[model samples]
Target: MEALQAVLKSNFRSFDRVAVIGGLVRDFAREGRTGFRSDVDLVIHDSKEEVALLAEKLRATPNRFGGYGYKSGPWKIDFWALETTWAKKHVPMQTLEDVLLGTFFDWDAVAYDLWERKLICHDDYLERLRTKTLEINLRPNPSPMGNLVRAIRRLVLWQLVPGERLMCFINEYLDEEALRYMQKKEEELFSYCVSSRWKTVEEAKFYLFQERGSDDLQLDLFQIKHQR
Candidate 1:
């Protein structure tokens, strides 16, 4: 974090606004464990023209997801304009006081203003964190798979219980067909992010099939396929 702070202080001082948002801020504020492997999302409130120049200045690559990917030592940082974020483009989620378009989860909605040396988060963010629960602030997202996988990841990593909305999201999107993609992503994510295993399809089903609304949610989701 010291390296990140130093780099930001030196490189981004000229910018009108530069803040660190997403998982890094959320994790750091709670545990101060912004270690070498930490990834960051930077919110640069600026025009795309200047942001592109800034990306070049930092020797960062423009990612396909409309962000600049820059590696500062062991930390990988993604720089983005506030207006151009996927959350901002798809949803009108004004769930954060500091950030206009909030992220999918309330836990991820926190941002740390580097210049101001302050943390900005939603009113319920800290409370939710303290309780170790996950809540969805934005839905009908561009990437539903990403959202579902993250919920599962958080459930394992943080031992955080999925809130009603979050469970509904998981139950809605995760079907037998979608489970294959979920497993693929889980294997990749587990290898890259952490070590976890579902072992079998049935095992994963046991964990994720907690019906949030209707009792027939699982039955409605799965269908028997008789084959020769």
Candidate 2:
């Protein structure tokens, strides 16, 4: 938090409405969580010129979604213009509230307002954190793998068991052909993150079923319980 605050003070004095959001915010608010190797995610309600200026200052290149990454010490900071966030751009979400609330995971559905020095949380976000539970707040996400990987991280590392909604989301995610094709270069579904957990899609299936204590879920190619 000190690091992030220092970053804003030095680099973004002129910018406004640049809030720190997602993993970092949740972890910081909860006083930290183990294995929390999350990159800093920020969204600014500023002009494209401001975003570009920040990119130039950070010597970073914006991705196709108009977000950029900057390496500061051991931390990699990812910055996106508020409108550039997936839910905002693709879902045509027109408000900051929409962007903030439209998240795949309950815990990451929060933002720390930099100027106002307050936290903006989505529904049941605080309660979920208190209970260490995993849930899907938004189902229309672009990356199903994003939700799954994060859920597994919580299950294995953070000890957060999935709720009914999250389990349903995971089940739906299982049917996504792209889940088997997990080689995409996306924000949450990094190659190392997935590869370190499971070498093959079948291995992932086995582990998930083993965790959830059920093999009723089926695939045309897999017997579900026999994936191992």
Best candidate, lDDT: 1
Q: Give the TM-score of candidate 1.
A: 0.79
What lDDT is reached at residue 8 by model 1?
A: 79
How would you encode candidate 2's per-residue C-alpha lDDT over 108-129 as one tens digit per residue? 7788777888778756677778
Best by TM-score: 1
Write one digit per residue (lDDT tens) for candidate 1, span 1-228: 677788778867877777888777777767877422468778787777788888898899988668899888877888877657676656653333446345788787788888888778766767878976788876657678777777876665555567888877877776666667777766664544321345554566466544343433333233211110
- Candidate 2 colliding pairs, count: 0
User: lDDT values of the candidates?
Assistant: 0.68, 0.66
For model 1 the local lDDT of residue 158 reads 53
Scored by lDDT, model 2 comes in at 0.66
